[model samples]
Structures are given as C-alpha cells and as structure tokens.
Target: MNGTLTTALAAGLGTGLALIVAIGAQNAFVLRQGILREHVAAVVAICALSDVVLIGLGIAGVGGVVRLWPAALTVVAILGSAFLLTYAALAARRALNPSAMPMSENATTRGRRAVAATCLALTWLNPHVYLDTVLMLGSVGNGFGDLRWWFAAGAALGSLLWFTALGYGARLLSGLFTRRRSWRILDGLIAVIMATLGIGMLTNALR
Candidate 1:
C-alpha cells in the first residue's frame, strides 16, 4: 500500500508539472506580474487556490461529467479564445509603447484589486485550465482508484510549488528586465503566445 501510494503521488506530481509548465496566458500573466513585483503574493494565491478547487472537482468525478457534455467545452473554448485575443492585443499595444514598459517603482505599481482581477480572469477564463486540470488531471487521478485522493493531493502540491517559485523566482530576473527593450521582447512573446493559443482554441472549436 505504501509503495502504491508513493507511485501514485509521483505520477500525479509529474503529470501536474508537465501540464502547468506550459507557457499559457495564465503563466505569462504571472511572469509579468512577478517581473513588475506587483501583487505577486495575491496573484500566486489566487492561481494556486483556483487550481486546488478545480483539481479537487476533477478528482471527484467532475471530469467525467464534463466529458459527457462536449458542448460545454465548446462554449468555454469560444469565450476563452475571445478573451485571449483581447489580452493579446493589449500585450501587443504595450510592446509597441516602450514608455509603458518602465520597471521603475512608479511605473510598475498597479492596484492590488486590478491585479487580482486579472489574475483570476486569466486562470478561470482559460478553457485549457478546464481541459487540463478538470478533465485530464481528473481522469488520470481516477486511475489510482481508491488512492485517487493521494494523487489529487500530489497534483495540488505541484501547483503550489510551481506558482510559488514562479511568483517569487521571477524577481531574480529584475536586472535583465530593467531595460525597455527587454520588456518589449517579453510582451511581444506574450502577445504571440496568447494569439497562438487563442487561434488554436478557435480552430479546435470550429472542428
């Protein structure tokens, strides 16, 4: 039993890390907030907690229900694609306006409320979050049968670790991002990522 539990935990951790490590809009937002050093803790908390809830639901068999109604994902895909495209446009605009890329204390400061809102939106509005955490992770966890809860716990730990590291570890890149050019590059990459993801979802939905 002990060996089986350990295997399940390791499997969950690996799966969680593999899915979360991708460069999605949520991650891009988190990275930007981390670089700006604005409301990092709040952003991290919202993202990590949101994952916990979603993963819990998934392991509880919400994944099977979601799979039964493919139309629900279609709706999510459409809405998520629209949101990503809008965010991509904003990121592109920011990239073009170097004046907006300053890392100075005065320039980077943003309201905690606004930051939290964006963080939540980025996490919750993305359809991939549902597909990954709720459906994929949940389905995988169920494979553990009676030990599925252990798998969920391990996945949740992975999320907590990843977000904590991403939110705090980004400060280490502060020196590099001090330049407007660096910010431009980062924002440009974000724009590309968002656009690509949005288009991909749109395509998938239409299929």
Candidate 2:
C-alpha cells in the first residue's frame, strides 16, 4: 500500500523477468524435454516448483546468510564454473555426434525420478542460480524496507509465469529442431552459452 512496497515489487518483478531470459541448464533441459513431448507436465512442474522454493528461501532472509559468508560464495563460484565448463564440453561432444535422437517418450517413474534429480542438481548446484535468485533478488527486496514482501511476491510470480511459458511453449517449435542439423545447431548454441557463462563467472570470481 506504500511507495516503498510498490518500488520493491516493481524491482523484484523486473529482476525476475530479466534473469529468466537467460537460458541456463535448467531452462534448457526443461525446454528440450518439453519439445520432445516427454514428461512435459512433469518437467514444467519441477521447474516451477523449484523456482518457488528458491524464491521463497530468498525472501526469508537466505541472502543474509549468503552475504555473511563471502568465502563460501567464492568457493561456490569456482565450483559452479567447473560444472558449467564440464557440461559445455559434454554438449559440444553431443553436437559432434550426429546420431543423437530426441527424447521421444515419457520415461518410466524411476527414469522420471532420475531426470528430476538431475533438474534439482542443475537448479541448486550452480552458484549463479543462488546468486541471482537468492542473494541478488533478496538483497534488493530487503532494500524496500517496509515493502519488501511485495517485492518478493512480484519476483515469485514472475518466476512462476516464466517457467510455465518457457517450458510449454518450446514444444511449438519442435518441428524445426527435428532435423539432425537443427540438433547440432541447438547443441552448439547451448555449448557456447554455457562456456560463456562459465568464463564470465570465473572472471567475476577472480575480480
């Protein structure tokens, strides 16, 4: 009801929307699985649910903990870079292999569980996700003083909307990527994106 609250909400919404645009491993996995029509609902559910949990933690003062332990964040940053680099290398290899097939069927429950586990790892293991969703967003919301809750609400809502749209809509373009060359291009792009993000994180950590 106050100006501070309004500002915080606006800031949170803006930050969430902006960050969601970046295609990370979680988003890529969700989109890829969605396009293949394999466990589409499950993938979207996991992505959205994970965002909700992380965003809620951010609003609950988790950022304060992250800020207090700079060394821990530095370690996370290095580890995240390593993970991203490793993933990028794997993606590059996949691109080089032209025999790859799109995921075509809903996995068994156990297989779905495995995929969920992988998604959880991708969502939580990367320091960038924590830094962006928890520390950065939470810190900014705290700056709203009396209106911090509104900002948190906006951010959470933004994340929910983004994951829903992205995870489902990617299927619309499934036809385009059914070709072998298209898979190669998509994998190549993913590899480049991951490597670039990893290098950027390493640079920031060093500085």
Per-residue lDDT of 127-175 in model 1, one digit per residue for the tens? 7788899999999999999999999989999999999999999999999
Residue 32, model 2: lDDT of 66
Which 10 residues in a row give candidate 2 its minimum summed lDDT? Answer: 101-110
Residue 108, model 2, lDDT: 28
lDDT (tens digit, per residue) of candidate 2 on 1-207: 767667777788888888877767778877766666667677777767777777777878997788788778677778778877887897798688765435324322336776677667667667777788887887777777767778878887887788778877888988897687887888888789878877887888878
Report the alpha-carbon TM-score of model 2 versus the true structure: 0.81
Question: How high is the lDDT of residue 72 in model 1?
Answer: 86
- Give TM-scores for every candidate, taking all chains together and pairing residue i with residue i: 0.94, 0.81
In Å, residue 39's CA in model 1 sits off its true spot by: 0.5
